[model samples]
Target: MAIASMGTTVLDCPDPRTLAAFYAAVLGWETAQDSDDDWVELEGPGGYNLAFQRSEGHRPPQWPGTEHGQQAHLDLDVPGDAREEAERQVLELGATLLQGDDGGRRSFRVYADPAGHPFCLCYPRPQDT
Candidate 1:
């Protein structure tokens, strides 16, 4: 049997509540449980789960050139016509826009959550189907 079973991704933050809320909104998930102030979880769309744990001295990562560095990132796919609106919604939900490129009107934009974890919103590359 394999050791990994696609459980959950845990992120350490100074305040679990804040991080959990941010992710809950971002992922369109709801808080499934709040075991304590130090621990919280959001129920994923399917069977996935995301948890946040409080750390006394948590330091957010810095990305790119590493003035601060990133520990991990998540990518989400959006439809071409709705990409702009989705980006706006994510930013409104507390994600900081990082960068994007012009790939003939369809592209991916990188962003960082409030906890400094990087993520991307992308439009699927044109396929030959």
Candidate 2:
């Protein structure tokens, strides 16, 4: 068996349509052509995509102190020099900055969406490749 490439990333939301719309606005992608009440998909750059399913009574994650630990997180890596600009964009798109230790030790900040999903903005580090 072999994997081709990333098809989609699905998230559970109390309301799939709303969550999908939120992401669509942020990502500047349109809703999937075949979207339904139960699920929605947003296309990503070069056909990468994200899907959301309607989940009843969904509970959002609690981070940092973790009364309920994050089941998963999305790490968004932006160019080191563009991290600040990207952070501004994310905030304008309705994500709340959840944590920041900008004292120079860490080079990333955590943010939460309107639905409380935690995602991180990481400054890319130089790599050999």
lDDT of 1 by residue, 1-129 (tens): 998788888888888888888877767888875457988988877788889899898777776757767767777877877777988888888889877746545467888888778888878655611
**What are the Cα lDDT values of the candidates?**
0.79, 0.80
TM-score of each: 0.83, 0.79
lDDT of model number 1: 0.79
> Ten consecutive residues with minimal summed lDDT in candidate 1?
98-107
Model 1 clash pairs are 62-68, 62-69
TM-score of 2: 0.79
With candidate 2 superimposed using the best TM-score fit, by how many Å does residue 45's alpha carbon deviate from the native? 3.0
In model 2, where is the ten-residue run with the lowest total lDDT?
120-129
Tell how far residue 38 is off in model 1, in angstroms: 0.7
